[model samples]
Target: MSTTLTLSTFDAPARPLNIPLPIDPPEGGWTWPPTSVTLIAGENDAVLIDTLPTVEDAADLADWIEASGKRLTHIFITHGHIDHYLGTAPLKARFPDVKVVSTAATAGIIAEEQKTKRDTTTYSAIFADDLVEEVVIPEALPADGRFDLEGHDIIGVSAGQSDTSESSYAWVPELSAVVVGDIAYNDVHAALIETTTPETRKGWIATLEEIQGRNPQVVVASHRKADAVNDAGALAKTIEYVELGDKLLSTDPRPTLAEFVARMVEANPTRANVTTAIYSGAVQGLR
Candidate 1:
């Protein structure tokens, strides 16, 4: 018999991690980490998809998990972005028995996440003294193996490269849900920093296409609109975001970063976290 599968979502409020720009002194602050994490509850155990960004954020999520009354069996990290899994250490301490796992490529990203955090001006400027000091490095998920839980198989979809390198999605068959990390964003500005070229951006869209091929009813993304958290149409919104980005980037006259930002902001007037993110993408020829 198929076990009854239940999924719950947790959203952390957005905060500032300042980033400097060439023209605009500072366009944004305190509106980014509307990060959404998932808890998949099964008959005897639970699985978590992605962690929050800061120690405080993780602690809050940890408390919620403990109160949920489900044993955290495996913490599934969707990708390697520090924001996506930085809270792994704190969660591990709270749930000592939980096995923290990720794709081999993600594990490699974890190894370098700290250094990346420390090196970034925007990240280090805000969290210089208090970054995730002790990152809980995860073991590689089984090769070509299904992450079995309560009769459900949590498989990883290789998203060639997204906002970061070696990104992926956690595809759970029983629930028809895909825990998309940074590969697909919902109602928020898609981070296009990684899509600096035509090829990579195409790859990102292809990854989104892969998600559609699975025909998931529940689409969960790491970053999402707080009001519409876990919206089933999130996947389409993400696809739209990227397509819009492409159009802005390859327009006739070649609009500058400033032009792209203004247009994107006007179009997505209410989307949170547009500052350095859009600037970066625009300058890098993404937006």
Candidate 2:
């Protein structure tokens, strides 16, 4: 018999960056929006989705999970972004036998991040003091993309592009929930750094639509505002943001990066991390 499941979240606070950016910093400095780790617990076992970005964060998350008194059976990474999987080593240290898996593509990307020293080089340029020193690339998930937790199924669906090229989300039918990594942002600026072009945005919109069609009762954004609600409505808001970004990029006599960011912020006045998300994307020189 399938055990009844409960879903919970550990929302990590925004990390202030050490690097300087072209735009004015917020309060202290530029900050990555807060990210979350979802826990799906059954009677005695649970599965974790997306490790946070740093060792200290993961250590705290480990303590939180330990308090739940459930055996962590697996750690499923939603994407290959350094922030998403960097905490794996600490979590693995805490739960030595927990399996860590991701899609082959994401695994390859994480492997590349390790091989290229992106953590110590590119990422280090900004979060030098906050990043985990060790790299932990997850093993590839089974081809079927299914994991069993107390007889319930958690499936991984491959997503073409979002904040990153190779991404995926976890689908848990038993709970009517979808752990959509960076595919959907809640009350935060959508990361446009990678998917600045119209075509890539279209693919992202399609993925969000697919998640919408599922009509999940619970939707978790990997990067979410602390106060934002976790519901399928986030999918529509994310699509709207992507569409607005596309329009802004295509404006005739295209707006200056400053102008572009101003229009986006005006449109999304309440969204957090305009500097990191909107500014960073525009700074990429998107046309």
Candidate 3:
């Protein structure tokens, strides 16, 4: 049988960001963007496309995978963001036979995240009890970024920058799916923590267009609404969101963090994690 794909979403609730912000959160406070983890299942084995963040969440994810009854042969990481890989060790412990892999650049970034304790220190303080303590770095994938499961090919496409640097995506040929970590955010605010300038924003759009050029039927975004459908349409939505961010930030006299957040909320009132996304942009992008 050909490979079939599925997803599990973790509805991570909004929490207070411990770091100081240019403006305070809305009355309702901030919520984190939900995470989506994909599973590509073949006849006898499966490949997990991404992992969740906290130990509790990963254990829950592990339970969900165990219920599927497919032997997980590999855990594929699409990027270096801590939220994408923090739960890896727990998953590794549960599926010891599964090999964890990512592009060499991603692996390098993962190492750097660990060395700098960016996640362990900052995120841990914010997430408090939800964060993972054990750090598990992945092995580097072959330079070509080709791997397989049950004879089907899964290639890693280079995504120069989206939310963060050294990002990449997983392309499954037989399934016509691309597991794009943060390259796209469906019905949610795009993470612009690292995407500041017009050039970088355009570059991100270029990368999304490149992924679109691949003509994949299924586009799995790492952060999305729990009920959002996976389809090629997300590519356009992400591109539009990035463009909106650039437009808002590029005014002759840029809006303050408060005005920026207010305008974003006005535009995307229904999008989840609006405060956190805008606050992140204010902190990183506005600087």
Candidate 4:
């Protein structure tokens, strides 16, 4: 049996709270950051990686999955970030029997985040009319750490702390593809709010190097460039952002957030989500 990999991207709506970038964004406003989801479809079954935050987006995703004419055996979340997994509840409500799986570490975070569920306050208080109002926790997958659909296998590789703790990627060896959640991003400013040190930055780069070592033909990320896909350039750009961050910050004077944004924006002027980088630039670069 043969298997194919498909991609889906859900661009989030603008947030109610405008990010306080040091200056007006290059485009003079915010960019709608997208959440990319991947589907591994085989002869008899399929596996989906990641979900968007909004109910409307996730329902569209569920419909897309159902229209594929394949049974969704498992939905694997690459990490536990609220935006990545918040829609799990709605997705499951649509596909009641589908198993929501995450790494053991991600599962812990989900359990804790859902237990308290304070994160939902932002959406309810502000964008109350936009999406689902619940968090659905996922169970840890089997100890073997692989999902088999039809006759193919999807392996999970742990990319520790690239974007968040307990983060990982789903590798489809048979198809030479890997769904690299936030461990890698393309043409979009990465969220460095979590990785805030030289050591951690190196760790982030190392994880990308690990993915490069596998030499997958396609690389999929949670946030991607317009019309982007899993490829060598995508991987290299991710490595570049982390490397540039460490180098620029290591220099004397420790550029302010605005200065850092100026340098980066000059180099990659066309990348969307410029506001995201500017918004978190100083904080991500500083100690």
Candidate lDDT values, in order = 0.75, 0.84, 0.79, 0.74
Tens-place lDDT per residue, model 2, 1-287, is: 44589989998988767655555665556777788889999999999999976767888999999999999999999988888888898888999999999998999988988888855567767763567768888889888799889989999888878867788999999889999999999988888887767888888898899888898999999888877899988899999988988887766767777677777788888888865654555466842
Tell me the lDDT of model 4 at 45. Answer: 77
- Give per-residue CA lDDT, model 3, range 10-79, as digits (tens): 4444444554565666666655667888888877788887788877788989998898898999888988
Q: How many clashes does each candidate structure show, in the order listed?
A: 0, 0, 1, 1
User: 22-89 in candidate 1: lDDT tens per residue?
Assistant: 44434444345478899989876899999876767888899999999888999988887677777888
Which candidate comes out best when scored by lDDT?
Answer: 2
Considering only N, C-alpha and C atoms within 3 Å, which residue pairs clash in candidate 3?
Answer: 14-31
TM-score (C-alpha, index-matched) for candidate 1:
0.89
Q: List the residue pairs that clash in candidate 2.
A: none
Clashes of 1: 0
Compared with the true structure, model 3 gives a TM-score of: 0.92
For model 3, the superposed segments whose C-alpha errors exceed 4 Å read 1-19, 284-287
**Sequence-dependent TM-score of model 2:** 0.95
TM-score against truth, every candidate: 0.89, 0.95, 0.92, 0.89
